[model samples]
Target: MKRILFTSTLAAALAAALFMTAHTVTAAPEGAPAPYRHVVLFKFKADAPKEKVAEVVKAFAGLKEKLPAVLSFEHGLNVSPEGINDGFTHVFTATFKDKASLENHYLKEPAHEEFVKLIKPVIEKVLVVDYVANFVDHGAH
Candidate 1:
């Protein structure tokens, strides 16, 4: 009757308030050691052949074996969930220990220089961004 309905409404309101309070109180702590994140976007030239593009992919993929600065790395072609992206031939993500390590990766790594040579002809444009991960949860991926 009225009493049962009143108790149920109060219980639901209390649960929601408790849930919001817990979410507010449990934020991650600050000043965690930062990880350098690198994102690369490649656009192949119009005249670039298919085999040459594939070679670029393969050559870039080989860097993980030779360069230890590449703590985490992956390269993939664009395949949209909605299926409508006609741009950006390739995307690469590489995580480094820090900013200086990333610079070392570019300057000291022979394999990366070699990769540049492989892509010089077929690649028309290259975009790179380096960032630090704040609260990167692997579970989301």
Candidate 2:
């Protein structure tokens, strides 16, 4: 009977530890800074030239090197078969070190300003979303 009781207690302790570990792994760190993501979606004017659009995308991607705040940059053309993009054809993502870097450095950087000027004429509509990137562990799901 004592052996059975000991085994049950051990099992309960092990289960509690596993539960704590899972929660710890899944929880976001308290007060830790995460990278900021700047997402831009562009819908070009119907008459916008293809070359100009290409140039704009190229210029935006180059901001990663031109701006000290940009940690990474990438862009992609919309290819969703769902046809629910609302006419947004291009998507660009720029990762910054933090919100401060994006708000202070990248926004005021001349290179970014130039890119905005270069793209403005051809761009019909633009949507930008900025957020602190709190990544969830995919495996945890």
**Could you tell me which residue pairs clash in candidate 1?**
none
The candidate that wins on lDDT is: 2
Task: Compose the digit string of candidate 2's lDDT tens values, residues 1-141.
Answer: 999999999999999887666554433456666778999999999999889988888898888888978888889999999999999999999988788899899998888889889998999999999987765554442
Q: Give residue 116's error in model 2 in angstroms.
A: 1.0
lDDT at residue 90 of model 1 (Cα atoms): 89
State the displacement of the C-alpha of residue 49, model 2, in Å, after optimal TM-score superposition: 0.9
Candidate lDDT values, in order: 0.79, 0.86
Clash totals in order: 0, 0
Error in Å for residue 128 of model 2 = 0.4
Cα lDDT of model 1 by residue, 1-141, tens digit:
899999999999999876665555322346556777899899899999999998888887778878888888898887768755446768999888789988977546878888888899888888888887765343331
